[model samples]
Target: MSLSGKEGGCDCGAVRFRIEAEPVVVNCCHCRQCQRQTGTAFAVNILVKPDAITVLQGDPAPHEHPTPSGAGQTNFRCSDCGTSVWSIYHAAGDGLRFVRAGALDDPHAVTPQVHIHTTDKVDWVAIPDDMPSYEGFYPGREIPAIMGEDNAKRFARAVGRG
Candidate 1:
């Protein structure tokens, strides 16, 4: 919590949040779960410390799902606008949190450090080789380690490898 960053709110401005610490990783997930939730080919996320994230305005409605990754993660959304705002996975450590990238005041400032769950990526989308890709949900372990083992499960779903 040594650093402080700009803060912003949800679409309706009813729910607000601030990230007091620098983010650990910025992500663009192409997982089916994320696609379904976002209704888009990919979803952007910013992983930060749970303690560093504070709700400055209102409470967010949460949607919990028992993911196959073996970690119990719940997605927090803005109830007023049905916008996914953040996610908290118990396995990631009590201090970790994942914020929706679009909610940032300067969304463009944050870029994807990794492209996760690429196996489920939409057929029409293109992936840049410069970034990392994964098949399964990255274990909520340390971000750096999780980002690399993507090598273990690198099959592309578009080709039907599973």
Candidate 2:
């Protein structure tokens, strides 16, 4: 489905944004770093091409933090409310963005296509039986199957793999 024109903002409404295109994929990450960063059991991130999102209002500040890859990640948060809206992993450079799904005006508009880093998930957390759960990152070879042919091509192009 086309997710174009979907709007969202920070908690304080200082930063507003619009999605200009359909997302490549949605990932529910259960890694310890994801839990600690979000202060939750898991983090739902909407993956899209860098240009897919457009800022409608306000400027979000970027904050860099450590990552397993040592290349680090940059999280963009509202300057006013300090609500993280999205992130750019150094590994992906400027190719892709990991938008916080919870920051969307209609968070439920998207659902996790895959669950990653499940090995570090909290004991009380349970993934649905039908969801694709991975102990670590999902295999690159499985992208086509999980994201469909079109989205997989988009993803590959976004990450410069195509």
Q: Which ten residues in a row have the lowest lDDT in candidate 1?
A: 151-160
Q: Please state the error at residue 24 of candidate 2 in Å.
A: 0.4
Give the clashing residue pairs of candidate 2, or none.
none
lDDT of 1 by residue, 43-140 (tens): 88876766778889999887887765677778888889877888876555445567887877777667787788888888998878766666755544
Question: Which residue pairs overlap in candidate 1's backbone?
Answer: 50-95
For 20-80, candidate 2 gives per-residue lDDT tens digits of: 9889989999988889878899999899888899999999999999998898999999999
How well does each candidate superpose onto the true structure, as a TM-score?
Answer: 0.77, 0.95
What is the lDDT of every predicted structure here?
0.70, 0.90
**Best-fitting candidate, scored by TM-score:** 2
In model 2, the worst 10-residue window by lDDT is 1-10
- The TM-score that candidate 2 achieves is 0.95
